[model samples]
Target: MTKIPRGTIAIEEAVLNPDGISWMAESATLFNTGADPKKASSHGHTPQLLDIHESRLAKMDAHSVEYMLLSLTSPGAQGEPNREKARKLAADANDWLAAEVAKNPARFGAFAAVSMHNAEDAVFEAQRAVKQLGMFGIMLNDYQVVGEGGDAEGKKYYDAAEFDPFWKAVEELGVPVYLHPRYPQTKDLERGTRYGDRKQILGAAVQFHLDLSMHIYAICSSGVFDRYPGVQVVCGHLGEGIPFNLWRADHWYNKPVKKATRPSKEDYSYYFTHNVSITTSGNFNTAGLKFCIDQIGAERCLYSIDYPYDTIEEAQDWWKGVDLPADQKEAIGRGNAIKLFKLPLEL
Candidate 1:
């Protein structure tokens, strides 16, 4: 086992249980690639996605990851169209994760997956996960389809007024809501054809970030923070490039003539600083890391491997050599997560 650095915590890792839902089994058919995701093809190191035992814990230990906050992979319960089925699948997945965390409470933390198809159930499950199952937070994959799957109008977002109760419960519970990304709906994906060449060029790489950025931007601009300032949100991949364009976004949207559409009274950067946190997940560029830190400060940054998609070794290797003060690196590498998630860490 690689000697873990004395106090490192890795958030943004993922766990997959095929038994909880049919999504995994049918992913091959649903995905354009038609390759079985169960076997893993080209999406990165996926074996760990299914292993909640020796393989996962061993990897964490080997790479010096003291603790891991695990969430379900993309489109988990979120993609299931049937409200009843989604709820059951979410509960099963969370229960499974709770059992996994029980195996080594000190080493694993769980982020609960909830069904947003039914907002009431969303709140209920989140409360149950944190209060009863001991999950640290919730992972909501971008959007959800309400009554039926295919209709574009059926899509619902957290920034919508209907989700206020869900956000309320999140704030009252005091756990972060991690906004993870999934591919856009089929209709939305079809619309991407306007930028066909570029869409084909970057494929899911660029589009995933763009799709997720829309949701993040909605939350930031929705003034959800004004009402529920206690709610915390976390997004991966260096704030989905929001940090770099923060000034431009706020300036354009807040222009006197355009200000009418500005949902929040505060500047966009305000929420970015106060209510949002970013993680170094999937993207390993040191320059990007430096920029994110300079933009958001080390206190709001956390280290994550995007495991199964990113390796623990890659994150450790890069993180160990991050060009910053030891204290600052420590803050991003582990301390921030410990503080944000309220992990038991003796400073």
Candidate 2:
């Protein structure tokens, strides 16, 4: 392994609970609150920061990560039942993030939050975040749950025709749309769960990748990729299981179904090559990273820490020793993110 530079960029470092203790209460669950009977007491507040500033610098230094692109945590605007409330929270979160980045422009940047309940609001916020706040892109928490109608049984996806406006805005602004995963709806959440409550959170850690991967497939098969060719979509955790099973996914497309409207060349691999990007977050396996780079190409892979859950030190310790070409490692660590987000490379 080649020596990584002293201060490389880790684009996927997250900034959760911007309102601090208040925001934590809103998103906290029993399992993640460190109240579970299974874990040790020392696991309390795994990524505790004295405050936001201390947290930011500490993790950055620990990982030798010079730049971090902050994002709102899981169940961000996606959990809001009311569109109006969701929109407000989205704006407030973006504003807070922008201000935080502004304090240390070189060291920090952010992905804007959006309320996917309303397509119009999602578009508006995307434009505002990029044009005004100078956000790198938009971070959406998996599928948006709007009323009782927006669950998995409802089959409501953001890539549908009705959500074209959101895609249009993203493409127009020339910013990437990161598809971050949330826990799946109740019906589809059983596969990865082991026990009861423990299963929910643990299942999330594992299954979110699968959920987002399926969403990517749905979008592509539904012709969303063909329609919005200019827009770039990124997924965390090594394309969220897509690369590992891509061959199988493509095999499914080969079996003749009914009349397929999309072009013959518009296969799963086409979307993988043309539209998608991946990040190495909690996944630290060297072989997996190398395999992903081989399958998807190094240009589409980015480095991330999945901070708060996976620490910067652990991530760096693993990443710094991964066996790959020097150029590929550098690209995964920083170059790809810079090119993808059009981030300023002053430093």
Best by lDDT: 1
Residues 232-290, model 1: lDDT tens digits? 99999888878989889988988997687677878778888899999988888899988
Worst 10 residues of 2 by lDDT: 42-51
Please give the range of 10 consecutive residues that has the lowest summed lDDT in model 1.
195-204
Shift of residue 214 alpha carbon in model 1, Å: 0.6
TM-score for candidate 2, please give it: 0.86
Number of clashes in every candidate structure? Answer: 1, 0
lDDT of each: 0.81, 0.74
lDDT (Cα, tens digit) per residue for candidate 2, span 48-160: 52134786687676668878888887667786667797898889889888887887777778899998876799999988999999999999878887665424333357767
TM-scores, all models, native as reference: 0.90, 0.86
Off by over 4 Å in 2: 1-6, 17-27, 33-51, 148-155, 184-201, 258-265
Question: Top TM-score: which candidate number?
Answer: 1
